[model samples]
Target: MNRAAHLLLFAALALPLAACSKVTADNYSRLKPGMAYEDVRGILGKPDKCSDLLAARSCTWGDDKSYISVTFVGDQAVLFQSENIR
Candidate 1:
């Protein structure tokens, strides 16, 4: 295949993989304070784990390479953190 064709094919395949990725810097960057839970889910997909606290709902998503945790009060995200990014 030509170089341009190879690059195009690679991007086509990689884009889907990127979309399926768990919470990482790329996806985590999309999150913002006060974003709705459903909007966050649309960006990062479902959390690997989640729980409810007295004041908020906590959710996490990550793999061995990286992790992100978010706290939501009512339906809005109040805070989030990312760690161990590679």
Candidate 2:
């Protein structure tokens, strides 16, 4: 592989890891009531899991021991919380 190809591959792999690292207390604190879903998504990257029932939606990032969760009702953030995040 050429030098440029190696750099491109490295960047592609590193980008997702960088995104995963965004799950922190500071970022969780950045979430607020009335924020749009896309806004939260931008701050937290893609959620690990999500579910919807009617106009309410719930999304969580990370896993059992540490996680961030946001509850949205009708496209606006209604509540959010985190556990064991640093």
Candidate 3:
């Protein structure tokens, strides 16, 4: 009975781990630095803020907590940075 209880407890603990999300559309961790703004926009949807990234040629997306800064040199995001406040 005790062994069965321990097995049940281990399975319960592992359940959440097994339930962890697989890579999908909403998973932003898969995003890369050089992806175009339009491509990224399609994946992330509208952003919280839009402004200059580095200079007038670049653009960025950010919020109060986190930010994804993208610099455009021609037709793509040539430079990118992500920052977290806290």
Candidate 4:
């Protein structure tokens, strides 16, 4: 293959790996009680989904088989859970 073709192939292969989520054990451990939503967002980028009920907000990242969920009250995280995150 030519040089440009090789470079294009490399970029295509690397893009998805670069875009992988940061929902790993190391980042999960960094979470603590009373952390603000913005703080968690800084580490996890964005939740896959979020819901609000009264003053409590629940947010989750990643898919069902491998995910992280956190419960926040008044913008402060109070509880968190994870599944199959390495």
**Number of the top TM-score candidate:** 4
CA lDDT scores, all candidates in order:
0.85, 0.92, 0.59, 0.95
The top-ranked prediction according to lDDT is 4
Instruction: Please write out the lDDT profile of model 3 over residues 1-86, one tens digit for every residue.
Output: 69999999999999998655322333356567677777867765555556563543554455544666556655566666566622
Model 1, stretches more than 4 Å misplaced?
Answer: 1-20
The Cα RMSD of model 1 versus the native structure comes to 5.8
Cα misplacement distance, residue 63 of candidate 1 (Å): 4.0
Q: Clashes in each model (backbone N, CA, C under 3 Å)? A: 0, 0, 0, 0
Question: Please, what are the lDDT tens digits per residue for candidate 4 over residues 11-72?
Answer: 99999998787899999999999999999999998899999999999999998899999999
How does model 1 fare in lDDT? 0.85
Tens-digit per-residue lDDT, 22-78, candidate 1: 666778888899999899999888888899988799998886457888899988999
- If both were scored by TM-score, which would come out higher, candidate 2 or candidate 3? 2
Sorted by TM-score, highest first, which candidate order results? Answer: 4, 2, 1, 3
lDDT of 1 at 75: 85
What CA root-mean-square deviation does each model show from the true structure?
Answer: 5.8, 3.5, 9.6, 2.8
Off by over 4 Å in 2: 1-20
Give the per-residue lDDT of model 2 (tens digit) for 1-86. Answer: 99999999999999997665777989988999999999999999899999999999999999888999999999999988889999
- Give the least accurate 10-residue stretch of model 3, judged by summed lDDT: 19-28
